[model samples]
Target: MSIVSSEKNRCIVLVGMPGSGKTTVGRDLAKRLGLRFVDTDHEIEARTGVKIPIIFEIEGEDGFRKRETQTLDDLTRESNMVLATGGGAVIRPENRALLRERAVVVFLSVPPPILWERTRHDRSRPLLQVSDPRGRLEELLKVRGPYYREVAHIIVEGGRGTPHAMVKLIEKELQALCEH
Candidate 1:
């Protein structure tokens, strides 16, 4: 429950569903903590020189996932960084292991309804292109919930708060660990 522990690495990884505000909160959290901030999805886009939706269109989810895993592997190795991971990063066992072993993994949990509200009009989410995006989100949550829990060292409620407020809550949690 504490951020301080036997783990020596200073990396903090944020994991969760697509609309959980990982990138926003992670950036603020990193700034508050004075660590580098990196969003895996953005890293992927930067490397490929295309938006994620474009990558999904060209390479399919499988190819994008391969790239995600590679990026996650590389980012987790760095010290003093806050990394916002892709939503489905926990689907792969290797990614889960790397996240758990190399850094403090925090799951930003938001209810499905809230997630839908946040992402409904976002065309960039490749997975939500279905006839019923809410249905897809619910389905993904059902399958991925356990993996998220399995890899998370902490679970933070990610709803009804500004990114700065969420960062404050996370900072409190991390500070509690440090105090111990």
Candidate 2:
């Protein structure tokens, strides 16, 4: 599969679960491709001057999601960059539509067990802050997996490894896609 360099030059959006290393991999992918990288979560925090967890606390998930949708809409419309979206971004049909229209949506697939081991100690993720974070992850996966699959142009298996390695693998796959 060979992908045209022109097509590969379009925005590359990374979608995955909380601990799937989207942000980290997006940065490396962007660097390797000479494209700008934007993490929607970081953009939200920067634009609002508040962390995501704090936003969720003050405005609730509904408010946070609205902001997320707006931000994604704006970003996808304005730039040809690598975007790392939130774990739940694909849950909304509108978001999925926008992503599919504007970018090469890639799902960084990681097993639930790997996700649990990776995120067990992370306290910054609002969705994973529950008393039973592992259970919550499972529930989320069940609901979101199909949506992720539906939107993904490519799916990369991301195990417990450095973001650079994952990025390398994705780049290879993407290049192959272009060649075909």
- The list of candidate 2 runs beyond 4 A from truth reads 1-9
Q: Residue 78 error for model 1, in Å? A: 0.4
lDDT string for model 1 (7-67, tens) is 5645899999999999999999888877889999999999989999999989999999999
Per-candidate alpha-carbon RMSD to the true structure = 2.2, 2.2
Tell me how far candidate 2 lies from the true structure as C-alpha RMSD in angstroms: 2.2
Instruction: Report the CA-based lDDT of candidate 1 relative to the real structure.
Output: 0.88
Q: Which candidate achieves the best lDDT against the true structure?
A: 1
Q: Across residues 75-125, which tens digit of lDDT does each residue of candidate 2 receive?
A: 887555889999999877899899888778889999999999989998999
TM-score of each: 0.93, 0.92
Clashes of each: 0, 9
